[model samples]
Target: MASRLAAALLAVPSAAAAELPAADLLIVGGEVHDGTGAAGRTADIAVRDDRIVYVGPDGERAVHAARILDASGLLVMPGFIDPHTHADGDLLSSDPDRRENPAYLHQGVTTVVIGNDGGGSPDIAEKAAGLENAGVGTNVGLMVGFGPVREEVLGETNRAPTADELARMQRRVARAICQGALGFSTGLHYAPQTFAETGEIVALTREAGKRGAIYDSHLRDESSYSTGLKASVAEAIAIGREAGAPVHIAHIKALGPDVWGSSGEIIDMVDEARARGQRVTADQYPWRASGTRISNALVPRWALDGGMPGLRARFDDPEAAARLRTEMAENLRRRGGAETLLITRGIGDADRWDGKTLAEVAAAMGSKPIEAAIAILRRSDARVASFNMDRSDIEAFAVQPWVMTGSDGSTGHPRKYATYPKAYRDLVTSGKLDLPTFVRRSSGLVADTLGLTNRGYLEADAFADIVIIDAERFVPRAGYANPEELSEGVVHLIVNGSLAIENGRPTGVHSGRVLLRQPSRGTCP
Candidate 1:
């Protein structure tokens, strides 16, 4: 091995060779996709410590290396960066395996952004510290969520915040940004964020914007749930315009039968915003079904006023119960009837509902779908995969340049484990998206959108976060019914210059870093 490495280094120019220290690892002979949406080129990459030292033509000047990997006939690219995810639940869990995040590593994801949908701790510093101390398999970025900030200042009540409360919320957002939060996120579709008016969102978002943070939103309506899909897109754009922040729509989709063909209109809206010099982008998961709690799918915003306890109380009141059922029935219809809602996770007795459709449960109980839904919710907040999306809509969004790949990974959903590979198979293998575009959207596009430096790219001086895949073997194994299966064909994955996956298996290394955002000048004390 030493003699071969020496012979390879013979071609190096004397001056340049002297400056190039022995690389920790050298990967040679692969089709390199640099995450720029450009065509792949055959090249070699050398890593030392946590940064790439070289990326150029194969075997031209292969400096000395302690370890050399032959990546011939493989796809080498920047490790995927999941722009939106719920993986923090696992990263912060006490379970060691969960912290390792093999499911994601298997999918070739080296970094994940959390605190999405307005649901992360406002204390970015504390959260970052906790994650680093606990150890993680993938680099994690923190986003200060609007949901928690609002919930902290104003309980779960469905009412407008007063001037004082709004100010307090603004302070929290600013503080989080200064403490290194990448940006501010909101899941306006979920309460108590649902109760907030557009102006209120703009007010709080301005805090993040002033600190150079973007606004990532889970639009208030993906279907005809409330503000209507197109209107909701406009509202998000308007919020960003008013707040002076770039707008990013999380898990962008045209959900439900009502908005099945709405992707084209939504794209036009985003295009118009971009044409006017507004920064607008989005992330998408390949799956047709969206995952969420059963109550979130059926319960009306007004009915969720005080949360579960309040909803339970109203379930017993005759008048309120009648009204609640009426709205829930309509919601059920909007979601394509009970048959389309497949329960993926539940609590206690409701656990049996897993892998069963709402319609199936309702049939077994000899109860109406609404009653069955309520009964299940009363027992536990069961999560369901609502298969309401149209394939054409998903494909339409996939082809958009601004729409990058994201998992929105949550438990009981195959996206958590198979999103990246599934995207490769569905989009690239199917010829809908070329390999370069797929890699670009999965990695560089996300990094640029999130303002992450030296990430989502494979270049000298860039972070050594990389993946090697056997293209023919890369495919997703997980499904809605079996959601925990890890993907196959990640031959090697490097996180922070350390091997996290080798030869299609985890190396049990916890080399991930908590990537913190640097506050803009004068933004921090």
Candidate 2:
């Protein structure tokens, strides 16, 4: 099949070669996937400066080059673009190595979208400036987060904002968009964000919509939490409809056992919205367990109104404590069972809980599961790998053309380092999806969804962000037990025309750029 596909590449005119100038680097004789859902073709690509100068057959003979990278017998394509990630913790860190982002570099990800789940800083300009000054390993795109916008105006209280406060929040969103934010994002499932009504979100989102920014959201509910999964998806669509903004769902999934087989229903909702001429898209990771803090998985949002101090105060009150315990027990049941929650990371003495299931920790502590969870949270909010998704549902979403791949990459989860390769192996290699489809979703599709220009494609005038992979070796080594393990199989990687990884090893080059949105014409002053 591979031989047939390669042989089918007929000689086409080298139009780009004739028009382009001399090349700095020429990559030759690779099975190229141009990131447009087209079949693999054996071709050569030429790069001069930060843009791809030419891509055609026999580029070595047509264009003169200073350096030649032999990508023979390898898969060459656009580097993966992750649409949702929590990489801000590493990208903005004081440590230089962390800023280099070796974990994602090895996974073939060239750009990552930060400030996901509504955790984006309200000060997008300041954050972009900081990352620019501090060299990073991959290109970054920023979003104006709803969490910080709400908190900046109305503390972390669980109440609707007054008209004046709502106006202030709207102004902040307008300011962020003008400052080059891609859009407004919301993690409606989290505290503070969870307190906002749909009306409040629409009012604020309109500011971004008026400026032609997208509305990306971590849905208000993935399970039976507050609104059901289907209802929450409807809400997201409605918000986008009312605000006149494109909707991008972050980590779209049927999260817990109670919602295990609901991916089909969720997909239909998105499709129906798209059918109505509404722009709606979503991203999903190829993993059974989703990574999050234990507190977020089980604690009620109202109980966390005043943050940790308020929660501690409630624990001391017998009546409040009893209610909290009852609700927590139900939440635990929704997430499968205590045994399904594996502690992945913790701080101080709580670190001892790593690698153990919540049920196991409860047994060791000689207490009920909810009590054990509270005890662990009291010390430190430990991160957990909650195994709740069903395999059938994952594949159902994977086959959808509108759904792209995102890592939601956070620490303590293998998805941080393995999302791209794992998706390739599971979806493409397993015959669930073809190679072209996989490359398209991981690359060009994401770029289109986010309104990114001149990236996520291997063509003339596009940024030279490319990945060369040994297909056999391109599999994830990371797992729940060893979450930080760097992925294998990327033989070469180029970020903005600089070799960041060569011959399967990092070159320690931080050539990544901080990509900011260009405000639509007639919208910004």
Candidate 3:
């Protein structure tokens, strides 16, 4: 079958070698699932100068071309665009081949949005250039982080931003957008940012808006009964109103037993905002649990008042340490207890601690869960996954037409390899959702939400970021116990009209770009 498909692709037309040179590559004979909200069909795809030139039935005449790949008996579709990710530092470090990222590509993800949670390198342009120079395996783009910028300027202290500070932040945001940031992101749940008054964030969002950028955020809280969940959503709405930027809630979730069925309310709120002329959207991973830092679960906003130094000082002071522990104990109960948190990544001796329930770790240490939480925070900094989401809530949010699918995952979680596949296996193959609806949420909906042009559909003249997989054999190989395994059933992947992956394997190609936000274009920037 491979040989036949290769022969069929080789038969496509090409110009003379000396004059303009033959096209870079051609792919033919596969089931094409254009990222559009449409069904799959068999078609031929041609590439010239890294852009898709033709997409139709393979013709009869055999013509010359530079390279060709066969994708017969495969499920071909648009390479996935992960709207939420935190792979910026990973892409810049020594292991930039990003073996973890291929787990995404093998599952049909060709492009990813990094710099999420308001935590990205300060120099985004440099980081983008470095990734391109080092030959990245997947397309990478980013959003400037409001939290990090605040941390850099204010050192995690709680206070209102003076007028000068606000201006400085806005200028920084504009520079980042000009340097290649798709938008601005915030993590109001984390420090320094949590201390920020609503008006400051609104101001920053407006700066991004002027550049035609979007505003994405991990809201202040997702589980609390009082102002925690609602206030966070309101904050994002407010930012959108003031900034004139589209508001995108990061990893929209209804976590804990307390809020098991709160998805409807959240959706209604977003709808209300939209009714008021505010552009709001959200993304979610297909998982029953959410991951984050241990400190995030325990450390009080006041305890972490002075950045790392302040926290370290409090850890050493006996009286202050006791007070910190007491506050953490209350926070643990508020967050559904230590049993809800699981260690995912750790350093040194903590490596053996991964996958253990926080309760188990506390028991082994002969300490209370709150004490154990403090110990882990002091020892490993913040690197834990909290099992806080409700399964019904996950399913409810996923089916929303306006709610796009995203792997709110990192290299540490199986969702990095399994989010889309898991959705396909459980939702579509199991009959919970039709194939077209699933594809619409995963591809077209996300593309449309971000205003990405020319790649979501398989029509002529579109950038060919495509994927092909086997529906029957499709399954997520990664699990919570072994979170790094690659997925199965992805037979081929094409990015920007180039064969980036073939037969469930990476072709080691580096044909991606840093997409920035510009006043002229919506997302291709």
Candidate 4:
């Protein structure tokens, strides 16, 4: 094995080396999905210069290659694309290898969309160039963040922007898109961003539309009432309608028990938008609980107007405290109470409460779960997890023809490790989504939706981004209670015609590049 690896290394050029033959790599004896939602077939894929050269059974017999991989008993499909992620940390951090994304590769994710929930790098151009120079484990892309952009310009106030201010923000969005941001992403439920009116969103989103970019949003609400799921869907549709942009609701969900059956309505809205010729789509992760910050549990938008400091002062003030408690009662009811919330991460001692539910921690503190939630946020710095979402709602969205799968999360989250696998195991192998259609949503649909060419397909001219998994044994092992664990059954992952993962282990090769949306190609509508 060592000698073979050495020989392979000698054959491949260093990152700085000049050009080489395109069909230098070969993968044989694998069942290919073709990334077009087609049935699997036995075929050998040939690659050269990072692009697929040949994709057929008979043509590979006479083909000679520098490296050959035996993929017998494995399903070779397009690498999974995480449509939503918080990997900005991975993108900008000092480390250049991007080892932290192994959890994604374990589940066969070859590409990820960072800059989610309105938080990410301030300079998309610099970040993109840096990641390309540093090298990474998987393909990465940027979505200009509304939160950081707002914070950069407006600070922590929740008021309507002046016409001049709005115009400046619009220019920033346009500049970022031209600098290679896939689209504009917003977390309107969070502070600063949430404070902006709907018109503000529409105006800025139009900038992305002019560049033919998509508007992916976390929505203004996911809770039960008063800016809840229905209103959230309405906002996304209206943004698309008003701005003439393709809209994608990030991590689309109907949260809370009161809105348990509202998934159908959300679907209907997306369908209606598409039917009316307004481009709209959504992504979902296969999980029963959504993750967020603990501070988000009880703090009102007004109280959080100044970011962390303002919220802390309000928590510390007795007069403000009293009013916050009254609001807290409503928040508890809206969130189905603190028992449904969990502390995911925080300061030094926070990791101890990582998997414990809100009820458990609250009981330990001898206080109501809501109070415990506030206490933890205050002490640990405001990170918490909400045990929201229904299995039926997850399945309903997962099986939709227009809905594609997304992790909608990041490291140490169950979705990060098990989302793709669980979706395939539950929705596909369990007879919910037919094999072809399932693979299509997981691979092709996303590629087409994101305007990613030479990927999401096993075709003659596509990038050799493929995954070989044991379909029967492929299932997500990570859960809400046990997040951060690796999944089972993904045997190999190929990135850009190179092996990034082998036999379910990362090969430490960071060959993935930034995939920017190229509207000039006329691929994305």
Instruction: Find the candidate with the highest lDDT and give its number.
Output: 1
TM-score to native of every candidate shown:
0.97, 0.96, 0.90, 0.92
lDDT of 3 at 145: 92
Local error of candidate 1 at 158, Å?
1.2
The TM-score ranking, best first, is 1, 2, 4, 3
For residues 1-525, what per-residue lDDT tens digits would candidate 4 score against the true structure? 346445544565554123433458777778888878778899988878778888887433435567677777788888888889877676566775553477788888889999988875558788888888878888998889898778777988878888888888887887788777888889988888889889999999888887788888988888753587898889889988899888888887878787888888888888888888887888988777787776666677788878888877888899998888788778777777767776666576666777677788878889987677677767665456676788888888887778888887665568767888888878777888887887788788888877777778888888888888898888888876688778888888888877877877778888889987665334323
Ordering by lDDT? 1, 2, 4, 3
lDDT, residue 328, model 4: 76
Q: What is the C-alpha lDDT of each candidate?
A: 0.92, 0.91, 0.75, 0.79
Model 1, 1-525: lDDT tens digits are 456556667767668876756799999889999999889999999999999999987543656667889888999999999999999889999987889999899999999999999997899999999999999999999999988999999999988999999999999999999998989999999988999999999999999888889999999999998989999999999999999999999999988888889888998999999999999999999998999999899999888899898899899999999999999999999999999999999988999889999999999999999999999877789999999999999999999999999999999999999999899989999999999999999999999988899999999899999999999899999999899999999999999999999999899999999999887789777
Candidate 3, 327-376: lDDT as tens digits: 87777776678887778887666777788888989899999887777776
Which has the greatest TM-score? 1
Model 4, residue 78: distance off in Å is 0.9
Worst 10-residue stretch by lDDT in candidate 3?
12-21
Steric overlap count per candidate: 0, 0, 11, 7
- Candidate 1 shows a clash count of 0
Residue 505 CA displacement from its true place in model 4, Å:
2.4
Q: Worst 10-residue stretch by lDDT in candidate 4?
A: 13-22
